[model samples]
Target: MKWLKFKILILIILMLQVEAKADGIYFGGGFYSLSAEVGNKSTSLSNPSAYSLSYTKSFFPQISFEIGYSFLFESLIGGDMSYGPQIGVRYYHYGTSTNSTASLEGLSIHEVKSYNPYLSAGFSQKEFQSIKSSYSGFYLGGGVEMGWKKNLSLFSDFKYSQLSGPVQGKANELTIIVGIIYHDF
Candidate 1:
């Protein structure tokens, strides 16, 4: 009876370990670059560096939701400074599996690399000559994350946004970001 109880305890511990790898919350911050176009202008104003912060929650091993904010450091054609919030969904693809679904059974917990692609939409408020205007848009982008430690990873992505309103002509913005995430396991 003692040996049987020990075996059951071991089994329960293994199951808990697998469950821990399936869900988590992560917070990250990084640098970003932005380029914006105004009116019919062929030349777009570009800022080489900006800052951003984000939070992501994983409900499954391969799926997560993210919310982020970015601060553009330089003045663009229509704005002196811009800041915004964005929300998106991320899908993780592991290894060479064409299906890209995450399976916990027999999966190694030490797996460190994955392909993550995401889609998002948000609103931005731009301040131009002391006047603030709001613009709404959607972003499409994809990125990859590489695990550095048990609960830490490094990631980068590029996104393009098409915004409407708060301007006379069509406005488009492009951004690239690189950051680190700390996951609660």
Candidate 2:
């Protein structure tokens, strides 16, 4: 629990420093499929869901830093609940285009593309209730974002997380998230 507190504290400090330059803030909820093996029993759940909220700031031209929390609505391995904080870096790929006006102006003007695809990888801490177990691990995922309106975009993400704890042997979760992001918030 001390480590979790420390991670949260670090994220809080970063958030405060990045708040004025935050590029976007998003909230999302989605479904997760979990497969876990403990001691002698193996279990799989296909219907549980999770909700996430995050803040992001651009650290480079194509890279952004993010911090967020994910909460599971159901238990894992008969535990009361599981949830944690996540910190990740996202890389955006922007397509290049040629503008005819560049020749006349002696300069290039690229059109602002509405579709952005990104890859994300992060570390997370999972704490389980009742069982009093805590697991820390990493996740990798990728998704796309499409502009929906001014200052708003829609995004979908799919990530896989593997965690291990003293109480629970190993747990893997596949999560799919669909959410909206508001820019410059």
Report the lDDT tens digits of candidate 1 across residue range 1-185.
Answer: 99766666665565443533333333333444444455665434566555567776666565667777776655432346677777876676542111111233443334344544444444443332333566666777767665566666666766677766455644567777777766543
- The per-residue C-alpha lDDT of model 1 at residue 71 equals 67
- Candidates in order have lDDT scores of 0.55, 0.70
C-alpha lDDT (0 to 100) for residue 10 of candidate 2 = 61
**Model 2: worst 10 consecutive residues (lDDT sum):** 95-104
CA error at residue 167 for candidate 1, angstroms: 4.4
lDDT score, candidate 2: 0.70
RMSD list, candidates in order: 6.8, 14.7
Q: Which candidate is the best by lDDT?
A: 2
lDDT of 2 by residue, 1-185 (tens): 99766666565554333323227787888888877778998887765467788887777766888899887767433335678899998887752110011111232222223667889999988887756788888999888776665456777888899988785578898888889887744
Candidate 2 lDDT for residue 173: 82
